[model samples]
Target: MYAIERFESRCKKAIESILKRSVELEVPPPEIGALFALPCHGLSKYPEELAGELASKLESLDIDLVGKIEARGAYVNFFPSGEFYEIVLREILQKGDDYGSGEKKDEVIVIDFSSPNVAKPMSVGHLRSTIIGQSLYNILTFLGYKCIGDNHLGDWGTQFGALLAAFELWGNEEELESDPIRHLFELYVKFHRESEKNERLEELAREKFRLLESGSEREKELWKRFVDLSLREFQRIYDLLGVKFDYVLGESFYYSRAKRLVQRALEQGIAKISKGVVVIPLEEFGLPPLVIQKSDETTLYSTRDLATIEYRLEEFSPSKMIYVVGAEQKLYFKQLFAAARKLGFNCNFVHVDFGLVTIGGEKMSTRRGKVVLLEDLLREAIAKAKQVIEERNPLLQNSDEIAKIVGIGAVIFNDLKGDRIQQVDFDLNRMLNFEGDSCPYVQYAYVRGRSILRTAGVTKVTLESVELLSDYEKKLIELLSFFPRIVKLAAETLKPHYIAQYLLDLAESFNSFYTHCRVIGSPNEATRLAIVSATTHVLKSGLSLLNIRAPEMM
Candidate 1:
């Protein structure tokens, strides 16, 4: 068990014993089970009559794990004993990388995120979903949950039709070889421009899509090429971000199953045909009717989503299905989940909606091309990071590698350091700052701790001399002991920012300890070294959960 758990148990046991000794206790003890910080204002929900009795009883009881116990009004507070700090330090050094993890669970969790469209360039809009999903995956896996990250690619729909028409009309073989996505994007933009002037061009695109859907030999081959080119381009970005998936299935992957699922829903009367379109009416649930098929008999997003859920249920039997999508699609997920339940999918469904990423207080629109490409954002971040590295640590080796880690880490940390539901403005200047609450700051703390250990040249740690510890040292140990609880809370709440914020707090505590307590020339140098070692390991582990790297020197 963790130090915090042990402390809570001991404190509860002490309170129970005190209540048992009381003779005027007509009712049982007010369940003084929860662990609260010292100097609590009052014990909420406890009877006012027993306030004095409770305080008097708690004051008489002696708990070895608790260094100090205070009873103010009806509230009881407990502070950790010196032995508590010793146990925390020992556990951290022994557990090392596995310090913050929990026992394994036998349930599978499937996370769906980063469903970038095939024919379009990945924009900044997809950033939140990608990073947030990856963070959740890492946290759940750390806590010993079976996790499968599925990248549900947008490989079907009208966009592909537009791309196919654009290629036939304006695509060049040489330009495609040079840069497929950019070339395809330009052609796609041109097609939309031409379609406005010639309305017939729109019909041509629709017909082309119909041909592709019906398995036309030529159109199918072209459609496959577009998917192949998009996947190859998307892979480069995914590699740079250090993200991978167990399944890279797309909307087209469910095409074969979607029709059957929709037909069954219609047969069961869960979905009905209205005006030649198949939809599930959810007005009772305060959501719009979920359209599974268009009037022209074409499968829509709802169809594919339902099909994906069905496939997952049969194959993985996941206990939960989490969709990390934009807040704009809040209603869409509400409708999708409602439809899934109506269709008899009994698994837990969670829609992790995140706020939008705006540039200069303006929403991004891919249709107007008023958006920053994710690749460009990453490149600019790397360049800025390189400049910082050159200015701060010019003589450092592997400058390029370190710059990449810091640059990418800055971008990710900036996105994750706030409440997931709050809007994020992509501010490179603020994100790259080395002094503030940024990735560089936490990473620098780790580097500084390592530098201390290296200078001391202490290969082993001895706890025998740790007879006396300062307030700063004890506080640092207390913060270290809370790592496992923090991780568990983050996973339970499906919020990565909790981990991000905790790292910042832990870094602040470590910095305080480093400032006041000298580790190298201290009376208990070996004990201090152990503390420093534990801090470095924890910082690295915490950063890893956020999918960031902790450099030895920054």
Candidate 2:
């Protein structure tokens, strides 16, 4: 890759010199000040005539052909140069998998995502955070930075206490033995209905919540059981998506220091006790004053969040913290961030929220009993992929593995192929299609590129002796040449969708080049093979950033 880069830069410089020389020795007025576009076509009848024409124009104006000007009417025009492209390309290939980096201790990123609540199967809605967070993690790591992935699990408070009380009242050992989470969920639902009939039962649940908060041994054991079981269930889904976290630390993790946090905010006069609730003044920030604590003195999400921020600032000392949660919690994040800043923690705190995945014009909800499981979706996607595999290539050796990659990749890509803030209407058929802007289309393109390389065996893209004279060849070169830049942009913006779009564009360019040019049978075998190698490398690099696999077979 470094050699490839050096060659490109040298070529640019050489072309610019030739352009200036041609202009200095020009013979026509129509050739004054021509700037060459690498893959342009002829104007009059001759290729060198246009180059000569460009040289004349550049010479007349006394504008040098050194990046400032160039000449030609298409047909792979040439330009003058300094050695910038070569320097950049060499850096990329030499860096190998890590091309974007700096030396001054760039920054630290804390990404909080995939926070499914306790006692519920992970629904497809949770896929947004898990995949989006994973992609962000990949991009940040690609750049020269330290990143922290924290799964802020919902393992806290009254809900668990209610579920616990309900479990005890409707105790069933056999059901718990079979499937604890689902069985607990059923009791949870029933408890709400039953409590509506008996106020005394509701009181017992509140008392239990108090006991859990007060750190009673029995209550502690119950809460621990719920948390442990919930985590194990979440892990299964995470494993399916290839997602891991630096910290499984959750809301409960910060419970011990919560009281101290509230007390400090109170002592500093940053938070006040009013109406028996703790609050942060917000009239100056242009919103209604927020409740930082309830009258009961038990903590709220705001309290836990503010505490988490305080803890993170003290513990990890992060430079940037990203909360990859849903758009529905936009106000909550804004309030939380504002409050944290007010409390005098000036580090970068970002709340990267995405739009909802709705079904029939309503937000997907688990408590409402209208939800789809992520496992189910993955299973379905794979099943459909298995069918496609059979139809496309039945004798494939590892059908299951391939189907899993393609199917799961489709689901991950479907959620990520658009603006993260744009709402999605779930459509299974559209996601599975291999013909459009889907994962399969990109995978097929990579496979096709690989096939070209295989047939052109014994030769690869290098800084070998070859000329890039064809317009199609230049177009392909330019496309692959922009990978490092594109990847850098995506990483800086914390957006994987940009990288996804780039892959689609690269694949399109490959397809177009294939349609217009002869690769394997070309007269200049080295040049054709060079373009082939560059395309393969770029595709592999791009797919890896998006965390998608590039199978060498269609």
lDDT, candidate 2, 1-554, per-residue tens: 33233334544555466554322122123133212334323234566566566555544443332344445443333333334333433444445445443333557778888888887788878888889998888777766578888888888877777887988889687887688788877787788778778988877887787788888899889678777888888887777777889988878888867778889988999888788888888877776666876666777767777778888888888998999998888877777878888889887888888989877768876545677778888889989999998899978888888898888888888888888999888777877777779988888888887888788674334544445445565555555655665666776777788888878887888888888878777776666665656666677777776767778775
TM-score of each: 0.93, 0.83
Question: For all candidates, what are the clash counts?
Answer: 0, 18
* Leading candidate by TM-score: 1
| Tens digits of per-residue lDDT for model 1, 116-212 | 9886789888889999999999999999999999999999887778888889988898988888888887888788888889998888888887777
lDDT of 1 at 412: 90
Model 2 CA deviation exceeding 4 Å by range? 1-106, 192-204, 458-460
Q: What overall lDDT, based on C-alpha atoms, would model 1 receive against the true structure?
A: 0.84
Candidate 1, which ten residues in sequence have the lowest lDDT sum? Answer: 21-30
lDDT of each: 0.84, 0.72
